[model samples]
Target: MPRTKPGVGKGVLHPGAGVGKFEVRRFHPDPDLAPFVEHLWTVRWDLGDAPPFVQRTLPDPAVHIVFERDRSEIVGVVRGRFERVLVGAGRVFSAKLHPGGLAWLGAEDASRLTNRRVAVDALFAGVDVAAREAAILGAASEEAMAVELQAFLRSVAPRASAEAARA
Candidate 1:
């Protein structure tokens, strides 16, 4: 089900702007990916002729990989609050990795990536960034995007140590 309750610092853009203008949906990860992933989330917006909406949020410990029409990046745990302006119509597909899941991606110190945005190819050597991005953005629905993302993640599943696994 979609996240109805407003998360920390969310859903306050232009208070009482009327419903149905924005939607945030979350989906469970495939069973095999549950160990390293929390879930996938998609944010869709259509502000129509209204002014742009500025959404803000406090950072969490989990790492996130955000995919958009023009770019995709592996966003490490942010150290401070950040804001994004939602203008026009667009959708963002994000994968929220579990706490300590960065280790699975070969990051020994997740803190090092804090406040940093790394290109996907910089981490996943064999991934075809363009193709993957196309598959994700071209998906007809959030569910379809989740399936594509899950498949891609499985194909590049990382190896984590026993200690990391326990963490």
Candidate 2:
């Protein structure tokens, strides 16, 4: 099936925004990780001298790992709508995991994480958080950031339980 274009239904959260102000890119996971991952998305923006932009979205069942310049977090499914304000010039790389994919990361119940944000180290224990953060934030472009993120996921290689597999 052909993938829908990015930003197609994204207007509710980013209304009146011109397409040229920022860039949104999506990528499929590596073949081995496809079942556990829906896709990766990166949003890069350079709104020089423009006012802050507020973006909102309806709740989604999938979990997400969001990487930013100073912090990274494992976000659980949100039961309510989500909102964020974009300020300055920066980018964010995120992994949208399949609804059941949280089990692969040792989460017993994905719903428990709903509306909660956990430190990356809490979910990815033993991984070098600082080094990984540096690599991701230091990437030159969105594509490079995606590559770094995919490599990190591959290195961790979390496994889904039988129930998750069925999901």
Candidate 3:
């Protein structure tokens, strides 16, 4: 199930997950985007002078659009576990897509992207991806980042098809 509340990271597997040292939150999609977007999310961590922390989790099989500074990506469904190393200080805003959302959003098929990542431009073409990424990442707060991402998601909602929507 998608997390509907803020400050929750159900998939996070760590001591005192999604709080304090590791901050995360989930925001529900707007009504118009409900079909394609499961939820929008943000993750922030500041390890400061400490050693890098490796985050581990068993992720659900779903597509995701992760927006970072200059490194935004369309992440495909992962069949296994997930891990990412966190260090220093950083934050990212992302959208968790529904099962058929990838196809609806422009990918030929979700299966083609399995265990792979493509530049966000592959799907959301024509937009200034770098500029958009910068705006989202540069937002002053997590809620602001989600708003930026939600606007982007809403911008693409019109292109989705009914068949793909049902998928």
> What tens digits encode model 1's per-residue C-alpha lDDT throughout 22-92?
77777888656678888888888999888987776677777887888767878998888777888889888
Q: Which tens-of-lDDT digit does each residue in 65-102 have in candidate 3? A: 99987778988888888898888888788999888877
What does each candidate score in C-alpha RMSD?
4.0, 3.8, 3.5
Local distance difference test, per candidate?
0.73, 0.74, 0.78
| Runs in model 3 lying further than 4 Å from the true structure | 1-7, 15-19, 158-167
Deviation of model 3 at 66, angstroms: 0.4
Model 3 Cα displacement at 92 (Å)? 0.9
Candidate 2 lDDT over residue span 74-136, tens digit each: 888888877877777987788889877777756557778888999878877897887887897
Runs in model 2 with CA error above 4 Å? 1-18, 158-167
Model 1 clash tally? 0
- For candidate 3, the per-residue lDDT at 22 reads 76
In the predicted model 1, the residue pairs found to clash are: none
The local distance difference test score of model 2 is: 0.74
